[model samples]
Target: MDDELVLDPYPSKIPSLMDPSTSIGFLQPQEINLADQCFPRPQCDFFNPFRTMDGSCNNLQYPTWGQANTASTRIIQANYSDGYAQPRKSVSGHELPSARKIRTAILQDVDKSSPKINLFVMQYSQIVTHDTEFTILKELGSNGPLKCCNKDGSTPEIIPKECLQIKISDDNNSHSKHRCLSVPRALDTSDRGCNIKPVRQMNGVSSFIDASILYGSDHETSRSIRTFKNGKLRRQLGPNGKSYLPNVKKATELCNVTYDSTVCYVTGDPRVNIQPDMAVVTILLMRLHNYLCDELRSLNPKWDDERIYQEARRLLIAMHQHITYNELVPVILGRDFARENYLLPLTKGFDDSYDQYLNPTTTTSFTAAAFRSLHSSIRGFIELVNEARKITSKIRLSDFFFKPDIIQKQDNYDSFTRGLLTQKAQEVDQYFTEEISELAVRIPDRHQHIDLISVDLERGRDYGEPSYNKFRQLCGLSEAKTFDNLIDQMDKKDIDALSKIYEHVDDVDYYVAGLLEKSKPGSMLGHTFQCVVGEMFFRLKYGDRFYYEFGHQIGSFKLGQLNEIRKTTLGLIVCITSDIYSVQRNMFEIPSSRNPLVPCNSIPKLNLSAWKEE
Candidate 1:
C-alpha cells in the first residue's frame, strides 16, 4: 500500500568529481547591463545622532553593508544543484530523506520542560529573530496566487519554478490525503542588484539589533506610526482602558480573524499578528516608548519633537543591546563562552572595538540552520497566570496564528504577561509537541496546515546550505568520516537514527545534525551552533559604530547615559512598561530560590536625568 519510493541509505557508487575551477553563473539567464543597476549610496551625516531608518550610513565607506533588503552573506561557498540557483542535491545526485519523514522519526512529541529557563526566553528569542532576520517568501507568480498542487491534493503535471512544495508520499499517515505542501521560494537580491554569481536570499529587515521590530525598517512605516507632535507612537484604547497598539483597518488579508469583532493590531513588523506573545512584547515596547517620551519631554522642555524622539529611540536601543548581550546571550551561550568570545558587555567603561572592515550582514548559516535550533524549545500551549502566579487558563499556540485578539480581551494582557514570567519553556531537544508538528500555521476554514520541521529542512536545501560534516569541520570539530564519528557529539541512539536515514555521514542536513548534538556545559546550544551564534553576536557588537558601549562616534551615547543603559535589564523593562508589580531581576530565568522575585521598585532603573542637556 505504500507508494513511496525507497532507496538504499548507503551510497552505491563514487560521487561525481567536484570541479574546483568552475565558472560562476549569473542568477538571471540573460545578460544584464551593469551600469543600470541601482545601489544605495547614502549621504552620511558624520555628526548625526540617530541611525538611518533602513540601517544605511552605519559605515561611512560602505553605506549598504548591512542595510535592509540586502543579500545575506555566506560562511562557505554555496552548494546549489546547478551551481547557481536550484536547490542543493546530494553528492551522488540522489534525493535526500523526506523532511516530513525525518521529522516523524527524530522529533516526536516528548513534553519536556526546562529546569530554570522560563517562557520569556523563548518569547524573547523570537523577538530577537524578527529583529535580525526576515526572508520574504514570494507568493505571487505571473498568474495570481501561485498554487503548485491540484484541488484533489495531488502534484500538478507541471510545477512552477517558484514553488518548492514538499511532496508527501502515500505512506505518510499524518498527511495521507495530501500529496504536497506548497512553499514559495524566498525572494533574492536579483531584482535590486547582485544579479551575478551564485544566488543568495535577501534579508528583508535591517540585519542588526537596532530595534527595527519596534520602529519600522523603512521610512514610510516609521512615519506612519508616529503622532508627529509629542515624540510618541499612535496607540489604541483596550477594553481595560489602557493604551495598546493601534488596530489596522484592513487586516482580513493579514490576520486570520474568526469573528467581525476580533481586531488585528499593527506594529513595525507585520508578523506581530503571528501569535499572542509577539503581540504582547510589541505592545510593551510601544508603552515604553510613550513612557520614555513623557519623561524626556519633561526633562528637556526646550527640545523639539524630533530631538526627544531620536533621543528616546537611542536610549531604548541601548537597553535592548545590553539586555540581549548581558542577560539573554549568557543563558544560551553560557557566561563563560560569551566572555571568552568577547560577546559580553563591559561592566564599567566604553568598548573601543568597532571595526570598520568587518561586514555585519547576517550569514545564511545562522539564519537558515543554526539559530533554528531554538524551534524545539517552543511549548504547545500559552499558559495564563493570575497575580498569585497560579495557572488559570491556557490557549493552544496553533489556534492563535495570525490571530492576536486574545491580548485585547478584558484583563487577558496582564494574565499572559504574568504567564510568560511564570511558565517554564520546553527543553531544547529532538522532540516537538503535536501543537507544533500537526497543527502549526493551521488554516481552519481551508483545512490546511504546514509542518514547521519540513519547512526548516526544505529551507536549508533551498538556500544551498552545505552538509553537516562541512559545518562541523568549520566549527573546529573533528571531521566525521563515518557515522560513528558522530558519537562524540550525539548519543548512540541518535547516531543510529541518522545512519538509518542518511546514506553517508556527509549527507546529513545541518539543521538535523545540529539539534542532535549534546549541549555544552552551562549552555543550551550544541558545539556547532554555539560557534555560529557566538560569531554573529561578536560581529553585531564590534562592527556597529552606533553600539551603546562604543564611544568617540557621533551616534555614541555619553558616558553618564551609557552607565544608565548598563543598569537596565529585561525585568525592569517589563516592570516599567506593564502593570506587573514584581518579577525576578532577570526575567529570562524563572523565579528560583537563588533568583528570587522582588518588587519592581527595588530593581535598578534607567536614570533619564543623565540625558538632561542645558
Candidate 2:
C-alpha cells in the first residue's frame, strides 16, 4: 500500500537499467514497421545518462546503449584556454556474455551426406496433385483451358498448360520441387448460361445466396470450471465441433430456392457453437516475448543475475514503451510503469542491503511500482473482451476492444508505435526455433517446404517416407520419424504418382487434407490454426508440459471436427444437382463423383497475355 515499497530499487550491487541482457525485437511484420517506421525518438531512451528531461538535451551526454560514438559534442569551459578532442574510448572489450548468435549460415552449405545426413541425402518419393478447371463444366464442357506449361524449362517439352500435368523430383538433396495453384473465375450470367431458361428463372440468370459469415472464433456459451481431487491442472473444453460452421446448419433447415444451389457452412449437430480462440492466440504472443528476452540475456556473461535481469527489464521496458507509446493507437493502451515514479527504492538493493526496500510502505498508500502492478493484474481480467474481437479480423481493435473517439494525432505517431498487429509470419529457420501454422485452415500447398526438403530414408526402395515427418526432421524439430521410407523414387513425378496410390495411402492422408483443407473457404481451417496458436502459447507462457497437454486436447478436438467436415463435404457433393457441364438432376440431393475443389484448368490468369510474358 505504500510508495516506498514500489519505488525502492534493488541494492547497489544489483544491476540497474544499464545492463545488456534485455531487449524484445519487434517480431511480426506489422510490429516491425511500428518500431522502425513510425517511432524512435530520444525521449523514449530507457537509460538516460543526462538524468534530466528539462530543456538540457544533448546527444553526447546520453549514455550510448549499443551505437558507436558517431556524434560530435562540445561543452564550453571557461578554464580551458585551448580546445582539444577527447581520445576515443574502446567499448568492444566488454564483450556481451549472456547472448548467443545463430550462425546465420544456411543448409545449402552443410554436407548432407556426412554423419549428420538427412532424408534428401538419399532421394525418396514423388507426389502428383492435379487441379481441375472450371470451364470444363460450363457450356456443357465445350470450351476452356486445361493444360499447363513447363515454366522453368525443366522438361524437354513445354507442355501446353491446358492439357499439362505437374511433376516433382528429388534426385539431389534439397527442395528441387515446385507446384502451382490453378486459379478459377465464375462466368457472368451475361454470357455462358444465357440459354432458353425455365419460366421462373428471372432475367435468364440464376443467383444463389451464400450463407457463410466472416470467420469468427468459437463464441463459447459455457464457462463452467471443474476441479480434480489429485491437484492436477484442469483444462477448458471448446465448443461442440458440429455447430462451428453456420452455413451447413442453414442449408438443411431452410427450404426455398433450388435446394442445393445455395452454398452453406453447415455441420450436423444442432447444439454446437463458436467463440474467441484465446487459448492459442495469447500463448503464442507471450512465447515470442520470452524468446526475445532470453536471447538478449545470454549476451552478458560476467553480468550477475541481478544485473542481467535489471538491464533486460530496462531494455525491454524502453523498447516496449517507445513502440507501444508512439504506435498508431489511443494513448491509454501504451502505458510504461517503471520509468515515471519508482526510483531510488528501485536502486536501493545491492547484496543484502536492499532487502528491506522490497516492501517498505510510502506515504501515499501505494508506491509507483505497486500502482502499475495492480493495474496490470486488473487489466488481465478484461483481456477476453479483446480476444472476442480477434476472431473476426486480426486488426479489428476498435470493434471489440474499447475505442475512444479521440484521434491518434499526427504527433502521436511518436507514442503508440508498438500496437501494430498483422499476421505476417516469419519463416521457420535459424533465427526462429519454429514457426507455428496456427490458422484455422491449411492453405493449399502449405506443405511445400516439407515436400521440398524430404528425401528417401532408405536405399533402392521405390517406397518413400511420409511427407509430414520428413519435413519436421529436415527442419531439426523433435518429432518421431515414422514411415522411415515414404519417399521411394526421387523421380520428378513422385507426388503425381502418390496421388494415384489408393492402396498405399490411408485415413491419415484424408485427415491431413482435413487439417490443411480447413483454410479453403467453407472448409473452416481457421479452427485448426487456433489450435496451433494455443499450443504455441502453452509452450511460451507455461513451458513444454503445458503445451503437450494442450496440443493433445486440440488434436483430439480437430479429429472430431474433421469427421463433421467430411460429412459436410459429402453433403455438399450430394446436394449438387448439376455437374460442371449441366444440371444432372433437378432434385437437390443428387449423387456426385466429381470433387468440388478439383481445378480442371480452372485457373484463368495463367494463360493471360500479360502473365505469358513473365
Candidate 3:
C-alpha cells in the first residue's frame, strides 16, 4: 500500500505525536517510474488521459511510507554499544538494511542537513527540484558599507552600504522561485553562505526599511544612460511627470553592468547600472513567500499569527540590504554616466522574450487571461490601500495589520489577502501602492461589482516580462520635480516649463488601468503568473547569488514551527515561519497534515483516477 498507490482521500497515515521518539525528520529523493492509463487502445484521446508518474524518496521513513514498505534502520555503533545486546544476547533474528543504504543516508546527511526536499516534479522523474536550507547571519556591523563582487567574494575598492537579501527555508510553494533567500534593505545578519553553522548566534533581521524606522532606521537610493534631445522626449517618469535632476553617477567609477539601455552593453560600466528598487522589492516579496511557504504548511495545523509576522519581517530586512547594494545601483548608473536618458528591455520583452520564452506553449489566449486577472487584483489592492490612506491620512493602514488593524476588526482581515500582503511586504518595503488611483465612478450593477471583486481578489502578481523600460523612464530625469529659485523671479512673462511637463502625467493611473483591465484569463497565464511570483520570490530571498544556491544545503537549520494555508483563488500562497528560517534551534513538524491544500491540487488533471486513492 504505497501512499502514492493508495486509493483514498488523505488517510490517517502519519505517526502519533504521543510517541516521544517521533523525533524530527525531512524528505530525501528517490527514483520515479509509472505507467500511462489508456482506454483499451494504443491511440488514446488527447484531451485527457491518465498520465501516471512515480516519485520516490530515500529516507524510507514509515509515517509517510505505506504498509508493506520496508523501513531501513540505521545500525549505529552507539546503538549497538548502548547494551541492547551489551550482555551479548543470543544471535539476533533482526535484520538490518544493506550497508549501502546506511552509508548513503549518513553521507548525505553529513554533506547536507536534514534529509531531503519534499517535492515532486510533474511529468519529470525528479523527486526534488529545489534545495531548501538555512542561513546564519554574518553581520557587517551597523556602520559598515555593503558591497558585491564576483562569485569569489572579493572585496571592492569601494563598497556600497545598501544591499538586497533573499533566502528560503522549507518550500511550500508549488513553484521553485517562491522559496526565497533574499532581501532588499540593509540588514543585521550576514552569512558565509552555506549550511555550515557559523559560530555567531542567529540575530533575526528586520524587514526592509530604515533600520531606525523598524526601530525606525533610515531608507533611500540612484544612476545614468543618455541625454534627451528636443522633441526626442525627456524620458524620466514618476508621479505627475516631472524631470529629476541630471543623473549623478558616482563620478569616480565606470558603471558596472548598469541595466540602463542597449548601448550600456558596449560602453557603460556594469557596476554603474544600479538594480531597481522595484526589483529589490520584487525579490523581497518573493523571498519570504518562498522561504516560509513550506514551513508554515508543516505547522499549518495550529501556528499563531505572531510567529508568521515575526518570521516575514525578519527576512524582509535582510533583503533590503542586498538589493539596494548589489543589483540596484549597478543597474541605474550605467546608461547615462550622468544617469539620464534611454529605454530598457522590460517592454520589449513582449516582442523579444514573451513570445519566445514565456508564451511558447499557449500564446496570447491563456496568458492574457491570467495577466488581466492579476492586473485587476493588483489594481484593487492599490485601491484598497488608497482608500485606507484617505480615511486615515497616511499609508499606515497596513501597519494596523501589525499594529492597529487588530483593534479595529478584533480578528482583522487576516485571511489570504492580508496573509499574502503581509508576506509580500516582508520582502519588499510597503511599496505596493506607490502610484495607483482608480476612477471615482463605479458601475452600479452589484453583480458586475462582485465580479470585479472576485477578479481583484484572485489576481496574482505580474509574471509576464516586466515593463522595466517604463520603469526606467519613470525614474529618470524627465520624471523628477522641477525646482529653481530663479523661475519664480522671471515668471511674469516667462513660458511655463512646468505646464509643459504636467500634461504628460495627467492620466498615468488611468492609462495603466485600462491596459491592466484588458488582460483576460486562462490556465497558462495563471501558471506563468505563478512562475513570475516564484521567480520574484527567489530573487528577493536570495538577492545576492554570491553565496550560491542561497546556502540552503549545509544547515542544521531545519524547519521548525511553520503555518501556511493560502489556497486563494489568486493562486497565491501566504506562509509564516519562525527561528527555523535562519537559526536552526528546533524540531521539524508533519507537513500537509495541517495544510488544507490537497497534494497536486494546483496542477489541473484530465484524469483523476490515477491520483485517486481507493
Candidate 4:
C-alpha cells in the first residue's frame, strides 16, 4: 500500500468540456448539437453493461455523457437576479451561514472516536449513490405553487413547498420559516428547460452502476421484481419467519403514518423506501439473489429458469464488481489513489485499460458535486448493537426516513446486521448530523422538516454545479484567485467563513467548496474532492467494457470465475446474508488490535465451484 503513496498523474491544464477544441462557451454549437440528440447507442454483441435491453446507450461512445446541460445551467445562473437565488441573507436578518451552518460550525462531534470505517462504509455510500445519481421524479405538470413563509397567519396562500423548513433568524426566538421546494429537474423533451434525463441505470448513460444492485435497471422494474422460481426473488416473510422485502402497496401508501406498516418493498431500487440503510443494502442483495439461485440449482441439473437467471445475474455482477473494486475502492480511494488509478482489481487478467473514449458517464461534477462528499459520513442515529457492544435500539437517523417499518422488526434483520458490524461512521469532517442537519425528515403530521443542508445546497444549484472555482479549474487545482488562494485548500476559519457567504472567489458553492477541503492523506477526500472523486472512479474503471477486471473481454470474468469473485467480501456479505453470527474480518474496519472479532464461519466464501455447469 505504499508504492511511495502514488502521486504523479496531475496533468489537465484545462481543456475538457469535452474538448473538441473546447469552445461552446455558454453552449450552442447548435446547442451542442442539440444536447447530442438524447443519447442513441445500442447494438450490443456481448458486453452486458447490465443489459439495458435496448433502453439505449451503454457506452457507445459516450452517448450524451450522462445528459443534462445548458452549459451547467448557464454557469450557475449567471450571478442570479432570480434564476433561483435565495441563500445569502445575514446583515442580521440571519439565514447566512448554511451548508448546514458550515456543517454545524466546522464539524463539532469532538472525537466520538471510531470512524475506523464500518456501517458498511455508510451502507456502501448510499449504494454508490443509488447507482450513480438518479433524480428525475418531479415532472407531473412541472411544479409551481410554493410561496410558504406563514409565521401564524394561519396558513393558505400557497403551500406544498415540497417539504419546507428554513426558518433562520436567531437572537433566541420567533416563528414561521421552513423552505423546501427544490424538486423540478426531470425534463428531456417537453422542453421546460430542456436536457435533463439521465435517470441512471439505463445501463449506459455512463454505465450507470450497472449492477442496479442485482437486476433492476427498469425492464418494467425488472419484471415487477422477479420470482420465476429457482432463480428466485419475490420474497416476503418477516415477523421473524425471516426473509422479507416484497410489498410496495402503492409505494407503501406514502409512508409516515408512525410505523407498524407502510408496507413498502419490491426492491432492485426504486430507492427501496429511501432509508434503513437503503433497506439494508436492498435486503443484502436479495439475500445474494436467493443464495445464487440455490447455488445455481445445485450446479445446473439441466438449467432453465431463464438459464439460471442469466447465470445468477452474471455472478451477481461479478460479486458487485468484486466488492466494488476489491472492498470499496480500497477504502475510499487511498490504497495509493487506488493503486495510482488502475482502480486495483486484476490479481490475474487482461486489463488493457479498456477506454472506449473514457466516458463512463455519471459526471455532473461527480453527480452534483464530488459524490456528495459523503454527507459528512451521516450517523445522527441508527444503532441497535449487542454481541456485548450493548446499545439495544436507537433509531432517529431522521426516524429511518421513509421507514421500511424499521425493517419489519422481530430480530430487526439481526439488529440491523449488528448495527452494521458495531457502528461507527460519522467523521468525514466539516460535520453534519443534527439528524442530517436539523431533522431532515420530521413530518409531525405535516408541520415539516427536511433541510439536509438546504438539500445539499439546493442539489448543487439544481444540478448546474460549476462553482468551487469551477472545480478548482477542473481539477488541475490552482484557480482559487484569492481567498488567499484558498489558503492551501481551506481552513483560515474556513476561509473566514467562506468570506461571509461568498461575494466572489467565483461564488464558492460546489457542494460548499467541496465540503470545506482538507482530508486527502489516507483519504477521506479533499483536494478538489479527491480530484473529482478520483476522476469519476477512474472513468468508472477504465471506461468499462463490462469491466469485471476485463480479462479477455466478452463479458469478462472466468479466470476461475474471477478467482471465486475475488473471495467476495463486505464481511463475506454479512456472513452469507444476515442473522449475523459474528463479523469484523475488516467489514470496513474498526474491530482494532489488527482487526479481530471473526467467526462468521470464519469469513471468505464466494466459491460457487467456479460456477459449475461444465
Q: Against the hidden reference, what TM-scores do the models get?
A: 0.92, 0.17, 0.19, 0.33
Q: Candidate 4 lDDT, tens digit per residue, 1-614?
A: 63335553443221232343321233232322333444444454444534453223445554444332212212112222222322333324433344444444454444343348766676787787666556542323545433344543234356442322333434312122533323333322323343333211112222345567445655667677788877687888877577877876664344554444466676655666656777877788888778888988898878877677777877776677778777787777666766755677877656777776655555555666667767777777778777766778888777667767777866777777777767887666566666665566532223455456656665565444556776665555657676778877777988887776666666667777777776666666676776667666776677666667676665576688777777787777777887677777777776767888888887767778777767
In order, how many clashes per candidate? 1, 110, 125, 8
lDDT per residue as tens, model 1, 176-219? 37777777777775545566557777888988898889898899
Query: What's the ranking of the predictions by TM-score, best on top?
Result: 1, 4, 3, 2
Tell how far residue 350 is off in model 3, in angstroms: 34
Whole-model lDDT values for every prediction:
0.78, 0.18, 0.19, 0.60
Instruction: Assess candidate 1 and give its TM-score to the true structure.
Output: 0.92
Tell me, by lDDT, which candidate is best: 1
**lDDT, candidate 4, at 102:** 48
Q: Which ten contiguous residues of candidate 1 have the minimum total lDDT?
A: 10-19
* Residue pairs in candidate 4 whose N, alpha carbon or C atoms collide under 3 angstroms: 58-204, 107-431, 164-180, 165-178, 165-179, 166-178, 166-179, 248-265
Model 1 residue 230 CA deviation (Å) reads 0.7
Q: Which candidate is the best by TM-score?
A: 1
Better of 2 and 3 by TM-score: 3
Per-prediction CA RMSD (Å) = 7.5, 30.3, 30.6, 23.1
TM-score of 4: 0.33
Flag clash pairs in model 1: 9-503
Candidate 2, residue 597: lDDT: 24
